[model samples]
Target: MNVAWYIWLWSDGSALQLQQPIVSTTRCDRPIEAVTAVTGGFEVRAFLFQSDQDNCGGGGVVPISYVAGVRDGWPVRVRPTYGPLATCDPQSLIVPLRPGGVVQLRVDTDDRAPIVEPAQKYDSLLVSELAVSPYLPEEQRGDWVLARAARGKELICGYVRMDQIL
Candidate 1:
């Protein structure tokens, strides 16, 4: 499921430009919302159109009717598979679960699972409140565990308390 991705940015006539507009099969008009370089690669946050109909080529123009209003930006990993510094290869932020990595979520009857943004207990944004179910373990963050689950169109990646997993 490896896909070609490019972080499209409107240059001030200073940065290097790509010979060809990076096209995506899943989205159109991918403007550079944010970019952060991690250990292995960079994580890009961009507003990806949910449509595959057309490639607007970064003109910032798309058929307005096709869009369902502005959606939340998603984080895409750009690893070594990228062509050049200006280009990127899209990867999922949430690591896939390995065999025997499944765990059951423990919560009270009316309690929802708390999924936070950072690994810390303080000042972390509450990403989502998931229901009790079988969850795939992505990674461990001290007293918290990073978990991944699909809740509609977006993939939920956040930390849950270690005591919440059974």
Candidate 2:
């Protein structure tokens, strides 16, 4: 619930216009980069660089998008969701990712370490500390991973954590 409320009613009905800040962007320069060699229908969540300080013309920002809810609610009739992934709550603005989809990523261990910020929440961040495992193993554990992307609107980037897909 970072702030994604689109409940309006103020034209002569009183008050109900939320924060009004919905941003699900894609400019490129960092975060969202996973390409272990995926290309059978599309599965490359983010990569764009016109100059990573000076890299120049190197692009790729695929199937990765974020936002949680928007199908037909008001905000003028918002509609941007393809569904393959797109979690909710951290504000809302999801779309894209429907090329060969498979997404289920959310891990929150204990003790500490689990704060990844790329677009305020997470588009990619697993750190790989041995595949992660430490949610209060004895009392002080840690691990973290949670970008956005539910399914059909595709927003969250790279994240596996379903016991690492078994």
Candidate 3:
């Protein structure tokens, strides 16, 4: 199945939307330079996925929330919105990391209240990636170090994968 995902970034009360067109049948891994250019001091990556469930139908946009933070260091305290029809649990947005240091992130849909499943043929699932990242400094660019910095700064470097069921 073909999936289309839109990646956006929000920081310091500002939002930077990406301009890259992404499509994936299985998975996608790419840099979100579009947003980093404006943020100018962080790194973020987003990954979106399509569920294997069957489609229901009643189509409507849902709100998906993305949060990131140190695993055991602190609680995830970031909320980004994705989709108008997506719904995920609050715990899914937690970022998990090792005691020493690591960046972990979680994405989920925020279906404010609970309601019976829609009669639509489309299935509700989670589609997400790392999030958005702030632009990184030249000296801070490296292998694992870059990833660490991006995570530590709470940068957004993730993407979300959305599938349209016909």
Candidate 4:
């Protein structure tokens, strides 16, 4: 079995952006609630895409997580996946958003896995949809000018070396 995983960030109701080339990694067993504080009354979503194959068969899975804040802004949510190494194709993950909030996505892999390609050894992390307005009509029901400012998208990306494991 082989699989590739990545993270995405969506904000301000614009389009879901990709956050690749992750620069850091952290482990948290709790739901992310901090994001609500940052977005006011926006929504957050996370997803995992997986595929596998046994000597006699094949299988795959795509799991999605969505959390909505009651008022505005919630907390950061973190989850983990368990399985064998899988190959990730280019543009395997996609995120959706409206447009004045910020969203960040990241991907990590087990360092113990044997490298099929040296270039693939690097884990890609991307950060997108930073500081914008929601693309939703309700989000823009108020002041029109302010609404336009809120409806934009921003993104970032980086990488984490295996030797820097914490």
Superposed model 1: Cα runs more than 4 Å off? 1-141, 152-154
How many backbone clashes does every candidate have?
A: 0, 20, 51, 57
Per-residue CA lDDT of candidate 2, range 90-164, in tens?
Answer: 322222222233334422222221222122322333232332345435333223333344333444433334332
Residues 42-91, candidate 3: write the lDDT tens digits.
12234333233212231112222243222122222233522112223322
Model 1, residue 84: C-alpha shift (Å): 26
Error of 3 at 39 (Å): 9.6
Q: Candidate 3 has what TM-score?
A: 0.18
Query: What's the lDDT for all of these models?
Result: 0.32, 0.31, 0.27, 0.25
User: Candidate 2 — which residues are off by over 4 angstroms?
Assistant: 1-12, 24-166
TM-score of model 1 vs. true structure: 0.20
Q: List the RMSD of every prediction in angstroms.
A: 15.4, 14.3, 18.1, 19.8
Q: Local error of candidate 1 at 164, Å? A: 1.0
lDDT of 1 at 151: 34
Query: Candidate 4: where are CA atoms >4 Å away?
Result: 1-41, 45-47, 53-60, 66-160
For model 4, what is the alpha-carbon lDDT of residue 55? 19
Question: How accurate locally is residue 26 in candidate 4, as Cα lDDT from 0 to 100?
Answer: 22
Q: What is the lDDT of residue 148 in candidate 1?
A: 48
Order of candidate numbers by lDDT, starting with the best: 1, 2, 3, 4
